[model samples]
Target: MTDLMETLIENREMVQPNHANMLESAHGGNVMKWMDEVGAMSAMRFSGETCVTARVNQMNFERPISVGDTAYITAYVYDAGESSVRVRLVTEREDLRTREREKTTESYFVYVAIDENNDPTSVPELTVSTDEGDRLRKKALDGERD
Candidate 1:
Protein backbone atom coordinates (compact mmCIF):
# COMPACT_ATOMS: atom_id res chain seq x y z
CA MET A 1 0.00 0.00 0.00
CA THR A 2 1.05 3.57 -0.57
CA ASP A 3 1.22 6.06 2.23
CA LEU A 4 -0.44 9.06 0.62
CA MET A 5 1.29 11.72 2.67
CA GLU A 6 4.72 10.14 2.35
CA THR A 7 4.10 9.69 -1.34
CA LEU A 8 3.25 13.31 -1.94
CA ILE A 9 5.75 15.20 -4.11
CA GLU A 10 6.68 18.74 -5.04
CA ASN A 11 8.78 20.62 -7.57
CA ARG A 12 9.62 24.29 -7.92
CA GLU A 13 10.37 26.53 -10.87
CA MET A 14 11.80 30.00 -10.92
CA VAL A 15 9.91 32.08 -13.42
CA GLN A 16 12.20 33.49 -16.04
CA PRO A 17 11.62 35.78 -19.02
CA ASN A 18 11.30 32.81 -21.30
CA HIS A 19 8.50 31.46 -19.13
CA ALA A 20 6.64 34.77 -19.09
CA ASN A 21 4.12 36.27 -21.47
CA MET A 22 3.98 39.79 -22.83
CA LEU A 23 2.27 40.83 -19.58
CA GLU A 24 5.40 39.78 -17.67
CA SER A 25 3.54 37.01 -15.91
CA ALA A 26 4.40 33.35 -16.29
CA HIS A 27 2.73 31.72 -19.25
CA GLY A 28 -0.12 29.36 -18.61
CA GLY A 29 1.54 26.61 -20.60
CA ASN A 30 4.70 26.86 -18.56
CA VAL A 31 2.75 26.60 -15.35
CA MET A 32 0.82 23.64 -16.66
CA LYS A 33 4.04 21.94 -17.67
CA TRP A 34 5.41 22.32 -14.19
CA MET A 35 2.24 20.94 -12.68
CA ASP A 36 2.21 18.00 -15.05
CA GLU A 37 5.81 17.12 -14.30
CA VAL A 38 5.31 17.08 -10.55
CA GLY A 39 2.06 15.14 -10.82
CA ALA A 40 3.79 12.54 -12.96
CA MET A 41 6.50 12.20 -10.35
CA SER A 42 3.92 11.52 -7.69
CA ALA A 43 2.31 8.85 -9.82
CA MET A 44 5.69 7.26 -10.49
CA ARG A 45 6.50 7.25 -6.80
CA PHE A 46 3.24 5.53 -5.92
CA SER A 47 3.32 2.94 -8.68
CA GLY A 48 7.08 2.46 -8.96
CA GLU A 49 6.65 2.62 -12.68
CA THR A 50 7.01 5.21 -15.37
CA CYS A 51 3.84 7.28 -15.56
CA VAL A 52 2.33 9.21 -18.40
CA THR A 53 -0.31 11.86 -18.19
CA ALA A 54 -3.78 10.69 -19.12
CA ARG A 55 -5.77 13.81 -18.34
CA VAL A 56 -5.65 17.22 -16.74
CA ASN A 57 -8.92 18.51 -15.37
CA GLN A 58 -10.28 21.92 -14.47
CA MET A 59 -7.10 23.94 -14.09
CA ASN A 60 -8.19 27.33 -12.82
CA PHE A 61 -5.70 30.17 -12.86
CA GLU A 62 -6.59 32.37 -9.95
CA ARG A 63 -3.50 34.56 -10.06
CA PRO A 64 -0.22 35.05 -11.86
CA ILE A 65 3.46 34.77 -11.09
CA SER A 66 5.79 37.32 -12.52
CA VAL A 67 9.34 36.79 -13.68
CA GLY A 68 12.02 36.58 -10.97
CA ASP A 69 9.58 35.00 -8.54
CA THR A 70 9.29 31.36 -7.61
CA ALA A 71 6.45 29.06 -8.53
CA TYR A 72 5.96 26.10 -6.24
CA ILE A 73 4.13 23.09 -7.63
CA THR A 74 2.89 20.32 -5.38
CA ALA A 75 1.31 16.97 -6.23
CA TYR A 76 -0.12 14.22 -4.06
CA VAL A 77 -1.64 10.83 -4.68
CA TYR A 78 -5.17 11.37 -3.57
CA ASP A 79 -6.94 8.48 -5.24
CA ALA A 80 -6.25 5.53 -7.47
CA GLY A 81 -7.75 3.00 -9.82
CA GLU A 82 -6.58 -0.43 -10.88
CA SER A 83 -4.03 1.23 -13.14
CA SER A 84 -4.45 4.95 -12.86
CA VAL A 85 -3.54 7.45 -10.15
CA ARG A 86 -5.21 10.76 -9.50
CA VAL A 87 -3.03 13.60 -8.30
CA ARG A 88 -4.19 16.86 -6.82
CA LEU A 89 -1.93 19.72 -7.92
CA VAL A 90 -1.50 23.17 -6.52
CA THR A 91 0.65 26.01 -7.85
CA GLU A 92 1.67 28.86 -5.61
CA ARG A 93 3.39 32.12 -6.47
CA GLU A 94 5.98 33.49 -4.11
CA ASP A 95 6.97 37.10 -4.05
CA LEU A 96 10.67 37.56 -3.55
CA ARG A 97 10.51 41.01 -2.03
CA THR A 98 7.98 40.59 0.74
CA ARG A 99 8.15 36.80 0.87
CA GLU A 100 4.43 36.49 0.32
CA ARG A 101 2.81 33.44 -1.17
CA GLU A 102 -0.55 32.98 -2.82
CA LYS A 103 -2.32 30.25 -4.66
CA THR A 104 -2.11 30.72 -8.40
CA THR A 105 -3.65 27.62 -9.90
CA GLU A 106 -5.12 24.22 -9.05
CA SER A 107 -6.02 21.10 -10.99
CA TYR A 108 -6.46 17.37 -10.78
CA PHE A 109 -4.32 15.25 -13.06
CA VAL A 110 -4.64 11.56 -13.92
CA TYR A 111 -1.66 9.44 -14.85
CA VAL A 112 -1.24 5.83 -15.81
CA ALA A 113 1.82 3.89 -14.85
CA ILE A 114 3.40 1.76 -17.50
CA ASP A 115 5.71 -1.21 -17.35
CA GLU A 116 9.00 -1.51 -19.23
CA ASN A 117 7.01 -2.59 -22.25
CA ASN A 118 4.88 0.56 -21.96
CA ASP A 119 1.77 -1.33 -20.98
CA PRO A 120 -0.45 -0.22 -18.13
CA THR A 121 0.77 -1.62 -14.82
CA SER A 122 -0.74 -2.26 -11.45
CA VAL A 123 -0.26 0.17 -8.57
CA PRO A 124 -0.21 -0.17 -4.83
CA GLU A 125 -3.12 0.74 -2.61
CA LEU A 126 -3.21 4.17 -1.03
CA THR A 127 -3.46 4.88 2.68
CA VAL A 128 -4.45 8.23 4.08
CA SER A 129 -3.56 9.21 7.62
CA THR A 130 -4.00 12.45 9.52
CA ASP A 131 -6.74 14.98 8.98
CA GLU A 132 -4.92 16.88 6.26
CA GLY A 133 -4.31 13.81 4.15
CA ASP A 134 -7.87 12.61 4.53
CA ARG A 135 -9.22 16.07 3.79
CA LEU A 136 -7.13 16.39 0.68
CA ARG A 137 -8.07 12.94 -0.53
CA LYS A 138 -11.76 13.63 -0.01
CA LYS A 139 -11.53 16.94 -1.80
CA ALA A 140 -9.83 15.39 -4.80
CA LEU A 141 -12.38 12.62 -5.03
CA ASP A 142 -15.24 15.07 -4.75
CA GLY A 143 -13.82 17.31 -7.46
CA GLU A 144 -13.08 14.51 -9.91
CA ARG A 145 -15.42 14.02 -12.87
CA ASP A 146 -15.39 11.61 -15.76
Candidate 2:
Protein backbone atom coordinates (compact mmCIF):
# COMPACT_ATOMS: atom_id res chain seq x y z
CA MET A 1 0.00 0.00 0.00
CA THR A 2 1.28 3.45 -0.82
CA ASP A 3 1.22 5.71 2.19
CA LEU A 4 0.24 9.36 1.97
CA MET A 5 3.85 10.37 2.42
CA GLU A 6 5.03 8.11 -0.36
CA THR A 7 2.37 9.02 -2.89
CA LEU A 8 2.96 11.75 -5.49
CA ILE A 9 1.35 12.39 -8.85
CA GLU A 10 2.03 15.16 -11.33
CA ASN A 11 1.41 16.05 -14.95
CA ARG A 12 1.61 19.12 -17.15
CA GLU A 13 -0.42 20.55 -20.00
CA MET A 14 0.20 23.46 -22.31
CA VAL A 15 -2.48 26.11 -22.30
CA GLN A 16 -4.08 26.92 -25.62
CA PRO A 17 -6.91 29.18 -26.73
CA ASN A 18 -9.18 26.18 -26.79
CA HIS A 19 -8.45 25.76 -23.11
CA ALA A 20 -9.19 29.42 -22.42
CA ASN A 21 -12.50 31.08 -21.81
CA MET A 22 -13.82 34.39 -23.04
CA LEU A 23 -11.50 36.14 -20.66
CA GLU A 24 -8.52 34.68 -22.51
CA SER A 25 -7.57 32.84 -19.35
CA ALA A 26 -7.67 29.17 -18.72
CA HIS A 27 -11.27 28.12 -18.43
CA GLY A 28 -12.59 26.99 -15.09
CA GLY A 29 -13.75 23.81 -16.75
CA ASN A 30 -10.27 23.07 -18.02
CA VAL A 31 -8.83 23.61 -14.56
CA MET A 32 -11.41 21.29 -13.05
CA LYS A 33 -10.68 18.66 -15.66
CA TRP A 34 -6.97 18.75 -14.93
CA MET A 35 -7.63 18.67 -11.22
CA ASP A 36 -9.79 15.59 -11.58
CA GLU A 37 -7.23 13.88 -13.73
CA VAL A 38 -4.41 14.46 -11.26
CA GLY A 39 -6.57 13.70 -8.25
CA ALA A 40 -7.65 10.40 -9.76
CA MET A 41 -4.01 9.46 -10.21
CA SER A 42 -3.35 10.10 -6.54
CA ALA A 43 -6.41 8.16 -5.44
CA MET A 44 -5.55 5.23 -7.69
CA ARG A 45 -2.02 5.20 -6.35
CA PHE A 46 -3.26 4.99 -2.79
CA SER A 47 -6.27 2.74 -3.30
CA GLY A 48 -4.86 0.45 -6.02
CA GLU A 49 -8.26 0.63 -7.72
CA THR A 50 -9.97 2.82 -10.23
CA CYS A 51 -11.32 5.95 -8.57
CA VAL A 52 -14.25 8.19 -9.29
CA THR A 53 -14.95 11.72 -8.26
CA ALA A 54 -17.13 11.97 -5.21
CA ARG A 55 -16.94 15.72 -4.55
CA VAL A 56 -14.89 18.80 -5.09
CA ASN A 57 -14.64 20.52 -1.75
CA GLN A 58 -13.44 23.84 -3.06
CA MET A 59 -11.70 25.60 -5.96
CA ASN A 60 -9.92 28.92 -5.78
CA PHE A 61 -8.47 30.76 -8.75
CA GLU A 62 -5.51 32.64 -7.42
CA ARG A 63 -4.29 33.98 -10.74
CA PRO A 64 -4.96 33.87 -14.44
CA ILE A 65 -3.20 31.54 -16.86
CA SER A 66 -2.97 32.78 -20.41
CA VAL A 67 -2.51 30.86 -23.63
CA GLY A 68 1.04 29.72 -24.44
CA ASP A 69 1.73 29.11 -20.78
CA THR A 70 2.30 25.65 -19.39
CA ALA A 71 -0.02 24.47 -16.68
CA TYR A 72 1.77 22.24 -14.23
CA ILE A 73 -0.44 20.20 -11.96
CA THR A 74 0.57 18.21 -8.93
CA ALA A 75 -1.52 16.00 -6.66
CA TYR A 76 -0.86 13.94 -3.57
CA VAL A 77 -2.83 11.74 -1.23
CA TYR A 78 -3.41 13.43 2.06
CA ASP A 79 -6.25 11.67 3.90
CA ALA A 80 -8.39 8.64 3.36
CA GLY A 81 -11.25 6.72 4.87
CA GLU A 82 -12.57 3.23 4.16
CA SER A 83 -13.11 4.03 0.49
CA SER A 84 -12.61 7.73 -0.09
CA VAL A 85 -9.38 9.54 -0.76
CA ARG A 86 -8.77 13.23 -0.14
CA VAL A 87 -6.38 14.75 -2.61
CA ARG A 88 -4.85 18.19 -2.91
CA LEU A 89 -4.30 19.76 -6.32
CA VAL A 90 -2.01 22.65 -7.13
CA THR A 91 -1.83 24.26 -10.53
CA GLU A 92 0.82 26.65 -11.71
CA ARG A 93 1.16 28.64 -14.89
CA GLU A 94 4.61 28.98 -16.35
CA ASP A 95 5.55 31.55 -18.93
CA LEU A 96 6.87 29.82 -22.02
CA ARG A 97 9.49 32.51 -22.52
CA THR A 98 10.84 33.51 -19.11
CA ARG A 99 9.60 30.39 -17.35
CA GLU A 100 8.29 32.44 -14.44
CA ARG A 101 5.46 30.63 -12.74
CA GLU A 102 2.48 31.69 -10.70
CA LYS A 103 -0.03 29.69 -8.79
CA THR A 104 -3.17 29.73 -10.91
CA THR A 105 -5.43 27.55 -8.83
CA GLU A 106 -5.72 25.13 -5.94
CA SER A 107 -8.41 22.76 -4.76
CA TYR A 108 -9.26 19.67 -2.78
CA PHE A 109 -10.98 16.84 -4.58
CA VAL A 110 -12.38 13.68 -3.00
CA TYR A 111 -12.54 10.40 -4.89
CA VAL A 112 -13.79 6.97 -4.03
CA ALA A 113 -12.29 3.73 -5.19
CA ILE A 114 -14.44 1.51 -7.36
CA ASP A 115 -14.40 -2.20 -8.08
CA GLU A 116 -14.83 -3.94 -11.43
CA ASN A 117 -18.58 -3.63 -11.04
CA ASN A 118 -18.21 0.12 -10.57
CA ASP A 119 -19.26 -0.12 -6.95
CA PRO A 120 -17.45 1.67 -4.19
CA THR A 121 -14.48 -0.41 -3.02
CA SER A 122 -12.32 -0.30 0.05
CA VAL A 123 -9.02 1.56 0.11
CA PRO A 124 -6.01 1.33 2.35
CA GLU A 125 -5.77 3.83 5.20
CA LEU A 126 -3.52 6.75 4.30
CA THR A 127 -0.46 7.17 6.44
CA VAL A 128 1.06 10.64 6.87
CA SER A 129 4.62 9.62 7.51
CA THR A 130 6.43 12.86 6.83
CA ASP A 131 6.29 16.51 7.78
CA GLU A 132 5.38 17.52 4.21
CA GLY A 133 2.45 15.14 4.14
CA ASP A 134 1.26 16.36 7.52
CA ARG A 135 1.53 19.96 6.39
CA LEU A 136 -0.38 19.36 3.18
CA ARG A 137 -3.09 17.52 5.09
CA LYS A 138 -3.36 20.41 7.48
CA LYS A 139 -3.64 22.84 4.57
CA ALA A 140 -6.46 20.85 3.03
CA LEU A 141 -8.29 20.69 6.35
CA ASP A 142 -7.74 24.39 6.92
CA GLY A 143 -10.48 25.09 4.40
CA GLU A 144 -10.55 27.29 1.27
CA ARG A 145 -7.48 29.32 2.04
CA ASP A 146 -4.12 28.76 3.76
Candidate 3:
Protein backbone atom coordinates (compact mmCIF):
# COMPACT_ATOMS: atom_id res chain seq x y z
CA MET A 1 0.00 0.00 0.00
CA THR A 2 1.04 3.55 -0.66
CA ASP A 3 0.07 6.54 1.44
CA LEU A 4 -1.71 9.31 -0.40
CA MET A 5 0.60 11.93 1.02
CA GLU A 6 3.58 10.23 -0.59
CA THR A 7 2.12 11.01 -4.00
CA LEU A 8 1.50 14.66 -3.34
CA ILE A 9 3.09 17.11 -5.81
CA GLU A 10 3.21 20.88 -5.58
CA ASN A 11 4.72 22.97 -8.32
CA ARG A 12 4.82 26.58 -9.39
CA GLU A 13 5.11 28.45 -12.66
CA MET A 14 5.71 32.14 -13.15
CA VAL A 15 3.27 33.41 -15.71
CA GLN A 16 5.08 35.55 -18.19
CA PRO A 17 3.98 37.21 -21.39
CA ASN A 18 4.98 34.10 -23.31
CA HIS A 19 2.40 32.11 -21.39
CA ALA A 20 -0.31 34.73 -21.65
CA ASN A 21 -2.99 35.38 -24.22
CA MET A 22 -4.12 38.59 -25.83
CA LEU A 23 -6.09 39.40 -22.70
CA GLU A 24 -2.86 39.47 -20.65
CA SER A 25 -3.93 36.32 -18.85
CA ALA A 26 -2.33 32.94 -18.89
CA HIS A 27 -3.54 30.78 -21.73
CA GLY A 28 -5.76 27.88 -20.84
CA GLY A 29 -3.61 25.43 -22.76
CA ASN A 30 -0.51 26.41 -20.86
CA VAL A 31 -2.29 26.03 -17.56
CA MET A 32 -3.57 22.60 -18.61
CA LYS A 33 -0.11 21.53 -19.70
CA TRP A 34 1.26 22.41 -16.29
CA MET A 35 -1.57 20.61 -14.58
CA ASP A 36 -1.07 17.48 -16.66
CA GLU A 37 2.65 17.45 -15.96
CA VAL A 38 2.14 17.74 -12.21
CA GLY A 39 -0.67 15.23 -12.15
CA ALA A 40 1.44 12.68 -14.02
CA MET A 41 4.23 13.16 -11.51
CA SER A 42 1.88 12.30 -8.67
CA ALA A 43 0.67 9.16 -10.43
CA MET A 44 4.23 8.04 -11.15
CA ARG A 45 5.18 8.61 -7.52
CA PHE A 46 2.34 6.37 -6.39
CA SER A 47 2.78 3.59 -8.97
CA GLY A 48 6.55 3.52 -9.28
CA GLU A 49 6.08 3.36 -13.00
CA THR A 50 5.75 5.75 -15.90
CA CYS A 51 2.20 6.95 -16.09
CA VAL A 52 0.22 8.14 -19.08
CA THR A 53 -2.74 10.43 -18.98
CA ALA A 54 -5.89 8.47 -19.69
CA ARG A 55 -8.44 11.17 -19.18
CA VAL A 56 -9.04 14.66 -17.85
CA ASN A 57 -12.48 15.19 -16.36
CA GLN A 58 -14.54 18.29 -15.74
CA MET A 59 -11.86 20.96 -15.82
CA ASN A 60 -13.12 24.18 -14.25
CA PHE A 61 -11.51 27.56 -14.71
CA GLU A 62 -12.94 29.68 -11.94
CA ARG A 63 -10.75 32.71 -12.58
CA PRO A 64 -7.95 33.93 -14.77
CA ILE A 65 -4.29 33.99 -13.88
CA SER A 66 -2.84 37.25 -15.03
CA VAL A 67 0.67 37.73 -16.31
CA GLY A 68 3.29 38.40 -13.62
CA ASP A 69 1.33 36.25 -11.17
CA THR A 70 2.44 32.94 -9.79
CA ALA A 71 0.63 29.82 -10.85
CA TYR A 72 0.70 27.31 -8.04
CA ILE A 73 -0.23 23.80 -9.09
CA THR A 74 -0.91 21.02 -6.60
CA ALA A 75 -1.67 17.38 -7.24
CA TYR A 76 -2.23 14.29 -5.10
CA VAL A 77 -3.38 10.76 -5.55
CA TYR A 78 -6.59 10.38 -3.61
CA ASP A 79 -7.77 7.13 -5.18
CA ALA A 80 -6.51 4.33 -7.39
CA GLY A 81 -7.49 1.14 -9.12
CA GLU A 82 -5.49 -1.80 -10.38
CA SER A 83 -3.61 0.30 -12.91
CA SER A 84 -5.22 3.72 -12.77
CA VAL A 85 -4.54 6.59 -10.44
CA ARG A 86 -7.09 9.29 -9.80
CA VAL A 87 -5.44 12.62 -9.11
CA ARG A 88 -6.86 15.96 -8.15
CA LEU A 89 -5.08 18.95 -9.73
CA VAL A 90 -5.67 22.51 -8.65
CA THR A 91 -4.05 25.75 -9.75
CA GLU A 92 -4.03 28.93 -7.72
CA ARG A 93 -3.09 32.43 -8.72
CA GLU A 94 -0.85 34.24 -6.25
CA ASP A 95 -0.17 37.94 -6.09
CA LEU A 96 3.50 38.51 -5.48
CA ARG A 97 3.03 41.80 -3.69
CA THR A 98 0.08 40.96 -1.47
CA ARG A 99 0.98 37.25 -1.14
CA GLU A 100 -2.66 36.48 -1.52
CA ARG A 101 -3.88 33.41 -3.41
CA GLU A 102 -7.08 32.41 -5.13
CA LYS A 103 -8.08 29.25 -6.91
CA THR A 104 -8.05 29.59 -10.69
CA THR A 105 -8.35 26.13 -12.17
CA GLU A 106 -9.36 22.70 -10.90
CA SER A 107 -9.51 19.32 -12.57
CA TYR A 108 -9.51 15.59 -12.00
CA PHE A 109 -7.04 13.56 -14.04
CA VAL A 110 -6.76 9.81 -14.54
CA TYR A 111 -3.41 8.20 -15.23
CA VAL A 112 -2.50 4.67 -16.11
CA ALA A 113 0.69 3.02 -15.02
CA ILE A 114 2.60 1.43 -17.86
CA ASP A 115 5.35 -1.14 -18.15
CA GLU A 116 8.49 -0.93 -20.25
CA ASN A 117 6.61 -2.73 -22.97
CA ASN A 118 3.90 -0.08 -22.89
CA ASP A 119 1.41 -2.39 -21.28
CA PRO A 120 -0.78 -1.47 -18.37
CA THR A 121 0.81 -2.29 -15.00
CA SER A 122 -0.64 -2.81 -11.59
CA VAL A 123 -0.21 -0.26 -8.84
CA PRO A 124 -0.20 -0.46 -5.08
CA GLU A 125 -3.26 0.29 -3.05
CA LEU A 126 -3.76 3.90 -1.95
CA THR A 127 -4.29 4.79 1.69
CA VAL A 128 -4.85 8.03 3.53
CA SER A 129 -2.90 7.48 6.72
CA THR A 130 -2.08 10.94 8.02
CA ASP A 131 -4.35 13.76 9.06
CA GLU A 132 -3.05 15.87 6.20
CA GLY A 133 -3.66 13.05 3.78
CA ASP A 134 -7.20 12.69 5.04
CA ARG A 135 -7.73 16.39 4.71
CA LEU A 136 -6.54 16.41 1.12
CA ARG A 137 -8.65 13.41 0.28
CA LYS A 138 -11.68 15.02 1.86
CA LYS A 139 -11.04 18.23 -0.02
CA ALA A 140 -10.88 16.39 -3.33
CA LEU A 141 -14.05 14.48 -2.57
CA ASP A 142 -15.89 17.57 -1.45
CA GLY A 143 -14.81 19.46 -4.51
CA GLU A 144 -16.21 16.70 -6.64
CA ARG A 145 -19.55 17.04 -4.93
CA ASP A 146 -19.82 20.72 -5.80
Which candidate leads the pack in TM-score? Answer: 3
Model 1 agreement with the true structure over 1-146: per-residue lDDT tens digits: 88888768877899999999999999999999999999999999888889999998778999999999999888899988999999999999987778788999999999998988999999999998789889878877886752
**Candidate 2, pairs of clashing residues:** none
- TM-scores of all models? 0.93, 0.90, 0.96
lDDT of each: 0.90, 0.86, 0.95
- Candidate 3 lDDT tens digits, 32-97: 999999999999999999999999988999999999999999999999999999999999999989
What ranking of all candidate models by TM-score puts the best one first? 3, 1, 2
Question: What is candidate 2's lDDT per residue for 35-76, written digit by digit as tens?
Answer: 899889889988999999999987999888888888889898
Off by over 4 Å in 1: none
Number of clashes found in candidate 3 = 0
- Kindly report which residue stretches of model 3 are placed more than 4 angstroms away from their true locations once superposed: none
Candidate 2 regions off by >4 Å? 144-146
- lDDT of model 3 at position 52: 100
